[model samples]
Target: MDLSETNQTAYRHPWELSRMEILLKELEKLNIRGEVLDIGCGDGYFDKEIIKKFPLITNIWGVDIHAERCVHQGKEHYVNSYNELQKDKKSLILF
Candidate 1:
């Protein structure tokens, strides 16, 4: 995960997810496009933030293995398989 680093942006602390300038900048760049999909979007809270930050995201897809996690979050689907995601071009995003 972005919050934890292991040769892959391992944050020394979880709070660092918000403190990292580079990450924020990268997010800003992507947000400007206002169209991003977060696959395997766990709780989808981050997805909601991405939509909020961008606002241009006309379509947001938040898929996860646990339907409980996607409950009533306005998430399109809470399916459990990667194949189920391929139905959309946004499926390019994978965990």
Candidate 2:
């Protein structure tokens, strides 16, 4: 159901879930491997969703400019800046 139709507090947003689903499908088709990095990963919501659907991608990382803006609902290797991540390797970076 839509959040507007429910009396309970929203745990997930429909739009976000839809976007994740599309991304998940595309990623699955690619048969991706290695690390995944989420930039400006607010609250790590998408990270949790991705991790839940793609457990094989264990090396996931999240980076946000301000640490305070992030929420750690799931266990993620969060960093304060993109500079903290490796510059040499290609990564699946999401904005």
What's the TM-score of each model vs. the native? 0.54, 0.69
Question: What's the C-alpha lDDT at position 27 in model 2?
Answer: 84
Best by TM-score: 2
Q: How accurate is candidate 2 locally (lDDT)?
A: 0.65
Roughly what TM-score does model 1 have, to 2 decimal places?
0.54
User: Which numbered prediction scores highest in lDDT against the true structure?
Assistant: 2
Q: Which segments of candidate 2 are over 4 A away from where they belong?
A: 1-10, 71-76
lDDT of 1 by residue, 1-95 (tens): 54223232232455544644454466666544433456566555566656666655665667666656666675355456556654544522424
- Hey, what RMSD does candidate 2 come out at? 4.6
Off by over 4 Å in 1: 1-24, 31-35, 75-88, 91-94
For each candidate, what is the lDDT? 0.53, 0.65
lDDT of 2 at 48: 68
CA RMSD of all predictions: 6.6, 4.6
